[model samples]
Target: MSAYTIRDATEADVPAIARVYEHAVLHGTATYELVPPPEAEMLTRFRAISGDGYPYIVAEDADGTLLGYAYGSAFRTRPAYRWSVEDSVYLEPSAQGRGIGLALLLRLVELCGELGFRQMIAVIGGGEHRPSIRIHEKAGFRHLGVMEASGFKFGRWIDTVLMQLPLGEGRDTLPDEATYPGTLFRG
Candidate 1:
């Protein structure tokens, strides 16, 4: 097993997180974004998700070097979609093929469940991206479907694969007002 620790992310971690994401955006198809967002933009995004009570976490090795980061965000801006969250995970090149991605994803699922999220979605960028698909599958996510040619990155068309995992109670029960995800949207 890898000797890595996973913990809640802080403002101090944004720079490393941004670096990891920038690498993905530039060299990998995991994200469709062509231009890497600056650290300041990443910090704003982190604050938004953290402010909404969503979980954002980072993983580090025994030496305390950041290996990767993951987080859950509202699937959509609409209130009806509040109970569903979309997850994103990015890792450093040196950290790939280790168990860090799975560790981070499982923790994200656990935290989202505790926050009363009904569903967790993984929007895998390319249909050919098996590593991401495998990680989500190992984390209890099911293959939802795929949108072919949904994105054009790296001068080629890419397919987007959607996977989903049901969180606490999922949609089997209606959420009480206190547990409703829309509560975050309320003024």
Candidate 2:
């Protein structure tokens, strides 16, 4: 087990987060983006997601080194999907397999559920990405399905794996409009 602390992300964390994501985009199949977005673009995205009242967090060591980050964002732009969120987690290469990713994910799920989200989805980029799939599974996500040959990256086609976890009351009960995360969607 690694020693780290998880906390809400601030603008100061964007640069480190961008570096982590850039490595993934450039060398891993976890994301389909062909080109890594620069820090400014990543900052823009961070503000958009956090501004929507979603949870974006970072994990850091006692020495303040960022190990990884995770966040929840609207699953889709449609109003009907307001209660569902898609989660993204990324870790520094050195931090992989150190239990940091799972920690970030569990925390993201807790924060999203607290904010009234009822469903969390993990869109694993490569069907063969066992570590991601295992992390999701460990955090209670169930295999939803897979999209075959849905992405072309690194000179080859890759399949995407879908996993889902129900949060809060899930679909067992109706959401209170006063506290629903959808309230953030309303202008």
Q: Evaluated with lDDT, which candidate comes out highest?
A: 2
TM-scores of the models, in the given order?
0.96, 0.97
TM-score: which candidate is best? 2
Clashing pairs in 1: none
Listed per candidate, the RMSD to the true structure in angstroms reads 1.2, 1.1
Worst 10 residues of 1 by lDDT: 177-186
RMSD of 2: 1.1
Q: How well is each residue in 15-114 modelled by candidate 1, as lDDT tens digits?
A: 9999999999999999999999999999999998888878899999998889999998888888878889999999999999998999999999998898
Alpha-carbon deviation at 12 in model 1, angstroms: 0.3
RMSD in angstroms, candidate 1?
A: 1.2
Q: What's model 2's overall lDDT?
A: 0.93
